[model samples]
Target chain A: MAPQGPRRGPVRDGAGRAGRPRPGSRRCAVTQRLAPRWLEAETFDCRDAFVETLVALASEDPRIVGVVNDSVGSSKLDAFRTAFPDRLVNVGIAEQDMVGMAAGLAGGGRIPFVSGAACFLTARAMEQIKVDAAYSRNNLKLCGMSPGVAYGELGPTHHSIEDVAWLRALDQLVVVVPADPVETAAAIRWAAAYEGPVFVRVSRTPVPQVHPADHTFTPGRATVLHEGDDVTLVSNGTVLWRALAAAEQLAAEGIGARVLSMASVSPLDTAAVVQAARETGALVTAEESVPRGGLGGAVAEAVVAHHPVPVRMLGVDAFAPTGSAGYLLDRYGMSPEGIARAARELLHRRRS
Target chain B: MPSTLSHAHLTLTRAPRPPAGAPRDEVVAQLRETARQIRLQDLALVHFAGAGHIGGDFSAVDVLTVLYGAVLDVAPDRVDDPERDRFVLSKGHVAGSYYVTLAAYGFLPVEQLATFLKPLSTLGGHPNRLHVPGVEASTGPLGHGLPIAVGQALAARLDSSPRQTYVLTGDGEMQEGSNWEAMMSASHYGLDNLTVVVDRNGLQQGASTEASMDLAPLADKARAFGFAVSEVDGHDHGALLDLLGSRERPGGRPRFVIAHTHKGHPISFMSDQVAWHHKVPDADQYATARAELDALAPAAGGAL
Candidate 1:
């Protein structure tokens, strides 16, 4: 059977782009339109965004609860616990038990948002996510905190570069990676209201807002951050800002590039991908995760299926060396300069 | 002691079925009829599907019949009620028995029994909660149901709801690490609202649990896990009901019942045979087994 509610048309922007249309565009249609509208100087971290949004949601609905694995301090949920002490369930350091307990809580009529380090939450509790949450169709919202190389210098064991790839392999799971605090808040609200299982990566690293304050968040839809026609630079998570910067650099070199913030990686926006292939002729995908089975792989799969176009995938190929998050990104060729160079090379190859 | 008083006290204290308000003889007769029908349905389903863990199904059929027939406070009408007690068939490969038990108890229609393991039937090889009405969880990979049951038990305690949670796992399935993890959590939480029934059928897929990974002194191990341990004949309906309904310990520790059972109970050729784990019965053997089960009238006393 089809999904429960009225089906939405394929999300497209004013210029007939992939995401919600621009302010005045006729394709900017949605059921609920209360998008985030934050000021430029209104700086907020993702942790702050998570706590503020959760507390507000809890106040409105008593069923909202937080399930953690003794990472309350790391997840910045101490304030949330103080506000709703009984609502926060800490299941010690056992990740499997934590996810299973969340499923149980959801079974008992509670909407549990399970938070923990992304590395363990995705790998350790993968079976639970597949069986209990997705297979059983439980209404559990999994918030993977501090994903990617945010735990830089701690080595590969601490980094969560495989979370996206791992979670993307599971069917019936909505994989989302919000670019900034506004997107994070919007994604959280969307998850609470959505009636299915969702896995959202909450980055610890800071990033500037790339979406408009009234930017709407929808599962399986891509957002066009900057409009260009020469080539498309697609990315999500912290790497989205880097992709936008790369697009600007490409524009400086007189190479117009379309930037797409690909938040939902599983049910990828194939129409936008095909449009980019037909209009732009080349594609470049960037992410703070492994290129294998992640955004790059997802995009490649879509391109090969319907539209075959030259594509450049940017991500860490091997276990990261010890360094800061920025240093690691630059070292792994994830910086704006690195991405721009890669896009330029792809465009050159396309001409040749 | 009269069986009436014994069954009455069992219902009064720990039985999950509707109270034994009916006449004692009537209750006994109902239990007998339910058990027989469940066996017949289970045998027919396994023969029709051409694939089933028939040995385990036959071994656990009596316990399931007793629970649904006269022990659980659940009915077809109240299946989705939050207050109804929950049963998780952890050993889900024996789904033929569970399907038949649920069907006989009116959780589903009897005609649906023919559709077991069909392409579009909800009766899959394993119990899937999304498809099955009374299944609490989808369990095929072992050791999953215990933790979920623990979670439900903890939820019951938190909500101050009197609904109890019961999970039945094969003796061999306990070797998974997840079961130990759940056991630790269940004890740590002091969940007296949960009962774990271990179908000690001895044989696993390849060999007996003892020969493969010995769980000898199983009762002591449960006690070490902070549970009130009880050992009984799994095929005896009265013994199974009484043991399943025992009171919790003073400290609110969880309960564990190690039910000693043959792999294929009441079947002369299949009982206690290791190869019968999932072996389908042939025509000749099937006829003999059906005759044996059909001849099994209600035991004169609690001696079955």
Candidate 2:
């Protein structure tokens, strides 16, 4: 049931472009329809997309350098090192130095992409991220690889579920989590061209290409995958693919659920969130990370202040038990069926 | 006075540079007088602001004086040069001395010293590179600057630039694990253009560093970290100049000069006293300390 949007205006003058999808208008074509029959075969890892794009960008821009903390193989930077031997600086297993030296390299008029494991890169070097990159407003791209439980049974110590929450609170930082290979490559090109601090997830987890080959990624914006009114589902990174799948399942059940794929976490698309609250009357956010903060927290804040709506967040809330990547996704109720079930439950809360 | 995001309005009273090789003895005497003046100014700023780390500031000021005056290819005009020498103040709690030394080098106006710690004054407790011309990094956090200096050294090599990078850290500051981490790659990269000077001021914040964490036998420690280690009386200008000469010894890893000094040196009462660490002196102590420094200093020819 598509309810009339609430009349309440924005809390701040710049809540960004209203999150509500205009009548029959779509920002991203990928959101307009389901996956075509021809697009069923090969999948691409976002990390591979990131390295290919980075190498291409580095060739034209002399300033681009890759700074890694002994994760050349994990981050897929061996090719980068071979291409630009002097440009790749392996700081030898020091995450703190990896980040700090990236800031220093920026200070010396070079653009450095500091890459490593998401867990160690974000948590181990948070202070450097805060002071050197964010507070000091240095131009450095922090590429976090194999985020979420992408490490599978490598355990909680390797889990980067807290990165979104930790980084989104910092000032002058842009946080983006691309859904698939096309968007991942697009996001890398954007981060490198854009000056100032940017944190992007270069995930090793493979997923079907969500965006078309030419589709571009924009910061502080959301791509409306499907426009519906019964409820809204929001997600990004690997979970966005599941979110889209969830919408398709809900559509089959005659529950018209809208789906929004958010790339930017810090400069969150409040307008779209407000629109989701007003039009859908309920919202369900699913991220691969923690239940709090992440995309859910950003959406909830918008919903509560501007247009109050019933919201249910889907993600791992506690320390995840040992399991493979696929098992963890299904175990934590992050599969398409589970997400669709959450959306139906939220719609119940809305209709009642 | 609001310190609101603008360049310092005050002008330099005099160009704070030495004449071309005046005489070895004269330059030493001028530098000694300059060092003494910097000490008194540091004390005054601390007294004015009612806050400072005067102990390490005093311990490090002489090392800063000799470097700014005799060493370092940086001048206010050449600050934009790609090949200019880079100096990072790793012991950044001593902003009073660093600021005063910057002033003495004409990098900042001598009058800007009055804004020390005042609200909105760019003269913050720590040096911010964005706020000052000569400041290479925004540092207050202890272990950060050494690593930044290592990156700069690496950058110089990448650029094939002849500029040398020098970083000054406290002996107590060496306890920060990041310092050792930076030192490992510094030699691994074979950075002969890098020289790290340890202001071996025996005091840390609360107690003597020997009692606090005991970074004793500091020279052996540097040599072990792949440095061509040297030791000098930190207060002696001539000996320091000799050690800091501009030369890259072929296959020499990196130079680590441990300039032995006492916290609050030359101030008889405050000397070696841990209480002087960030403690602003009272009027009587200030007057006595100034008098002691003034007796040795000649007419403050160069005061930042």
Candidate 3:
């Protein structure tokens, strides 16, 4: 149903590779060292960080409980179930029931963190999430694990590309996608403490450490990792590091680029987006999601409303063909070179 | 809120309780009268509002009255008590019935009945926990309530509170796959404190349940799903209270009560009639149904 949305301006295939820069593209200052060529060898799974932070928080607060749809192993809740055996409620493959149960549990004065695969949790039980959690304003945390095509070999059915767009459209739900382990841990802590419905996308695909150990996540706030003026590169979740690499490539070519990590997608960091649009003049958005209603859509809305600017959105725009997660991202124009090329294109559009 | 109550209705609800240690027969008689009154008020709500699921409302009334009147350990005053028994109306389209029951019991003001289905009324086609005070969960979509009830029952157990959890679902609503899922968990957890009541009316909208989707042998299905199951006459106040309030609930098992009922029950010409599923009665039909309910009213001196 989504593939048929009327495209704006031209009928370009959503995933068509119209602009690709060769490897010999102009050398930027930090391209080789930071553009994933020297990609850090260390990788930490955010799901583990999620469990660690949840266990610590649950220990401090008795109201915290874990709810799952037979995802104890997949959602990394085995340790949680062991730590607080009775507190973990596994409903066994019923996503709708799992969400509704969480709503009822929250209504009963217990803080429930509902965890499951992002694909099923968002699509299979969307109505429950909309009415029971968001409309009712229940104190619940929806931990969407292994989000954004983390299950690469399993194909499109397992991909959570539509989660941000689907959930962001529903009011009262705060959509969050942590860029790395540190942000993932911080985001988990924040959602557990907040007193309303929240969807925290906790990834399974490992990424290098990005934020500080002490970094505290605040909702609706974006972190500016690198400051520049020529163009703003907005990204989050599994693709943020690749965007960081894209910025390094831009820097090596003497193209100053601002990088904004937009973890909060629903109640987005509008002020930051507007500032980037006005100060930087052009932008490119890289996300591990569809080009619609995600980081790209949110930034475009904010920019058009406050300050109009040429925006190039680089993300998965169609059903991914069979490939590993990294291969799929590169094929969908989410690679460092791809993002850098999109940034250059956005600058050229601004010049025109 | 319903603001159209006559003076007799206002005076009748002045006493919130009968004397403590009241005779069982006397309490059951009072409950029957209250259930009759719930039917009458819901009928009026449908007539005045020009819309409601009256068939389901009438079928579930006796069971609901028995719970709010005799079984549930709750008060309008203690609605927020963490230890209080939780009652969720899973068949929520019949909210008019539940609202008046709450009003009759003083959980909601009686005058609020006039506001039902009005523009921007708190009472819509379905219950909303946010807008309504006593509704535990807002349910319209079938199969949502039992799972939530399972969660509530689980929560009570975690607190080690003796607070019981009760949820009422329509017979036809059992077709939703979610109820069976909840049934599995209710038994898996050995939730002895939870009781699920199915208003086994023979009809849903547009057709008999048997014709729509046969859900017969429901008791055995529930048993297989891990619940100790029983069937009762839904309109029999004494039978409903006895089965629902029984303290002999076995260990490590949830209780399922199948209250056999007829859609638009007891109202001659409407009983078991499929058209009344959500039909708003005209002047003549309302008068006939209202007269039947008035005749069933407890003799003024019999009980409270």
**Best model number under TM-score:** 3
Candidate number achieving the greatest DockQ relative to the actual structure: 3
* TM-score for candidate 1: 0.88
Which prediction has more favorable lDDT, 1 or 3? 3
Taking the tens digit of each residue's C-alpha lDDT, what string does model 2 give over B1-304?
A: 2312123323223325567667777777767777876786777778757888998899898899989988898889988787889998988899989998899778988888888888998999999877888888888888787788888888888888888889999888888887888888788888888889999878888898889998978888878889999889998887876678556464759889999898888888888999988888877887898778766746644322
Candidate 2, CAPRI quality class derived from DockQ: medium
* Model 3 misplaced stretches (Cα beyond 4 Å): A1-38, B1-15, B300-304
Candidate 2 residue spans exceeding 4 A from truth: A1-41, B1-15, B250-252, B299-304
Local lDDT at B207 for model 3: 92
**What TM-scores result for chain A when each predicted structure is judged separately against the true chain A?**
0.87, 0.88, 0.90
Tell me the TM-score that candidate 1 gets on chain A alone. Answer: 0.87
Ranking by lDDT: 3, 2, 1
Decoy 3 TM-score against native: 0.91
lDDT of 1 by residue, A135-210 (tens): 8888889999888887777778989999999889988889898887778888888999988789999877655567
Give candidate 3's error at residue A22 in angstroms: 23
Compare candidates 2 and 3 on TM-score and give the better one: 3
Model 1: pairs clashing at backbone N, Cα or C within 3 Å: A13-A21, A36-A213, B16-B71, B16-B72, B16-B73, B17-B71, B17-B72, B17-B73
Steric clashes per prediction = 8, 3, 11
Over the full model, what C-alpha lDDT does candidate 2 score relative to the true structure?
0.80
Cα-based lDDT at residue B227, candidate 1: 89
